[model samples]
Target chain A: MEMSALWKLSYGMYAIGTLDGERPTGCIVNTVIQITSDNPVIAISMNKNNYTYDCIKRTGRFSVSILSEKTTQNVIAKLGFSSGRDTDKFDGDIFAWEYMDGLPVVNENSCAHITAEVITMTEMETHYVILARVQDAKVTSDYNPMTYKYYHEVIKGKAPKNAPTYQAPEKITDKETWACQICGYIYEGDLTKEPEDFVCPICKQPKSMFKKQ
Target chain B: MEMSALWKLSYGMYAIGTLDGERPTGCIVNTVIQITSDNPVIAISMNKNNYTYDCIKRTGRFSVSILSEKTTQNVIAKLGFSSGRDTDKFDGDIFAWEYMDGLPVVNENSCAHITAEVITMTEMETHYVILARVQDAKVTSDYNPMTYKYYHEVIKGKAPKNAPTYQAPEKITDKETWACQICGYIYEGDLTKEPEDFVCPICKQPKSMFKKQ
Candidate 1:
């Protein structure tokens, strides 16, 4: 079948937040939907192997921070590409966040925030669909929230194995194209000789971010 | 905090197929997600009040036909605005579909067809998150999949009260603009007097299909 057709499905990027014991932790997810209106229930699909899933299982609570276009690449690199098991994913200047109901929430230029209590979980082979009831919700910004399409076509972020929208890496086609060292954005033309001020279109990193293969 | 940020989230329009007793029926939904890769699992959020939800509970099976940009607005009006319990939603030429694994599958110029078996269900405050394992899958066409954005901006389709994405109808700002009588698309200038051959930018319906309000 045409797998590319499935890729055309639109989605939004989000940072899922939860607590691991006394420490706050979370991961990135693209699947979060409002399941109900009256009491405001939501559903989120998460990989069973994710550290945030384990945390949610223990705490029975989590938060969804709707990321905006202004969110920096370092935030995704720390909370998404890196595993919380190996590093303190929320530590340092990479992200600025605060605690809500004892759970850490990343404030990395997000447009909205929602905290929910897990109501049920259904296991589906490689992933878990978690249904939760909204406990606290707050609007944070007027910025436009980032779409999953924009994350790929504009931000130039790669979907890791855990992402529901993950696609197998594409083979390189041309020799003149240069790839961003940080976000893997392919530049179709020679960027090396451009002014030193040139920045990566997807991640907005400076010219130093580009590396030739 | 800006609640308007929710406007940035992207979604798709679909006709969720199910069986009602010996008859086939379905409804509109905006929330569907691929939960896994290997065995291919999907999750859909449906309001408890929808007739299709009851049908799915009894049948334990359903089909998802991912609508394309080419689908007619009448398909949504026939299925979305009317209740199958009282109306023969599929009667006349309202919609063209066939039974698949005993459930109706819409053939309205969709991008793909997915038939799944219900594995688990979680009850939320006002809706249900139905997780199903895909049993059959097929690609139907190469047309661009219709996004919720395209539905609103192009076809002028509005989310029903039972839809997870339902928002208060936006106020119309201009009167000179000609709106598609069926899907609500507003053209920059009046096209009603144009030859009956004029077509809508969204659902692709001919001017003959529109009725000026």
Candidate 2:
């Protein structure tokens, strides 16, 4: 019964775009599969606690932006690390987007994009599996896509509690390690010696989110 | 925009266990989601064309055996490349399994085993997503799980047409390339002069399934 073998499975990162009334918003999701070919249909699993779920329920539409290896770490940091409820996720002009199906899709250098309309949503106790029909799709790049393993190994990212694959971070052996309370990014070295305003590189959270351990 | 960055999503490969009447049989699936926590529920997407789907439809129950990184390629060759319609997939004692919720579960080697009953099913054009509640669950191993990416890279396995992510193999540039007509595993070098015992590595189809192109 080896659990390590499960790591062999492949996955691609994506940003899901949806709207609440006229406000455009989106979140990160790892599970997106095409269920049909003719009139192509796709599905995405979103945690019930996510704010994007409520927005998709209201708008009945969403878009998928396929993240490439070239995508900066800030994409996941901006969309995944914080809740859209607190701040406007797209406010900083950090991402360039376009309006489609009445929603904002991150056009900031992605590999491919797809806009879909929610056809059905099945409620599970903790998550919502939203099946949708692809309305439009386009290719953005030819670079190789970044896999989840590469993200963990290269980007050194951690899954949040709201993520479908949420697992607690492994305890670090570093004598002085700090973890971001928001996104769970672990800082190996000391930060107190630096400026009091030092922020997390992944989520941009203030040093206050860091806890000495 | 680099398309290579599209790969950072996470996914795990799994052997979906089910009973064909009283006999044990199964197939491979990449999508498995935990829909609920309390009275836990799980959802899996199966292609309508796969033999495993019909078996689950008849039994109304199935077990999800989360494959670990240690899972051998032979297991996939047995359960995935070969069809249960002709051969007894569970025969030869290849996997150690037990009946749970009236369905067989692979207990020999997996991260975790979960048995569930099909509570609801939504039919898509090419596939069916069955939403089920986890009737029983148990940890089988602590090993890291096998992801789809690892399967492609390490095992050199390709997705079948029934898979949601199946993409047509890229055309070969070299002449005298022999391709498997059944599952599309291609032999780039000259294969015509090979022994008469040549068989498709993927589907185990006879050499007759090969086409000269």
| TM-score, every prediction | 0.73, 0.70
Model 1: lDDT of residue B40 = 80
Q: lDDT of each structure?
A: 0.73, 0.71
Top candidate (TM-score): 1
Q: What is the C-alpha RMSD, rounded to one decimal, of candidate 1?
A: 9.4
Q: How good is chain A of candidate 1, measured by TM-score? A: 0.75
Measured with C-alpha atoms, the lDDT of residue A38 in candidate 1 is: 67
lDDT of 1 by residue, A1-213 (tens): 434445545578899988888888889898888777666777889998998899899999998888887775556766887677766777766569998667777786888888889988877777888888788778787665777765775456454544543332232334576767775555656777899888764456898877774
- Steric clash pairs (candidate 1): A139-B1, A140-B1
Highest-lDDT candidate: 1
For residue B64, give model 1's deviation from the true position in Å.
0.5
The residue ranges of model 2 lying beyond 4 angstroms of the native Cα positions read A1-12, A96-102, A107-109, A142-213, B1-10, B93-102, B107-109, B157-213
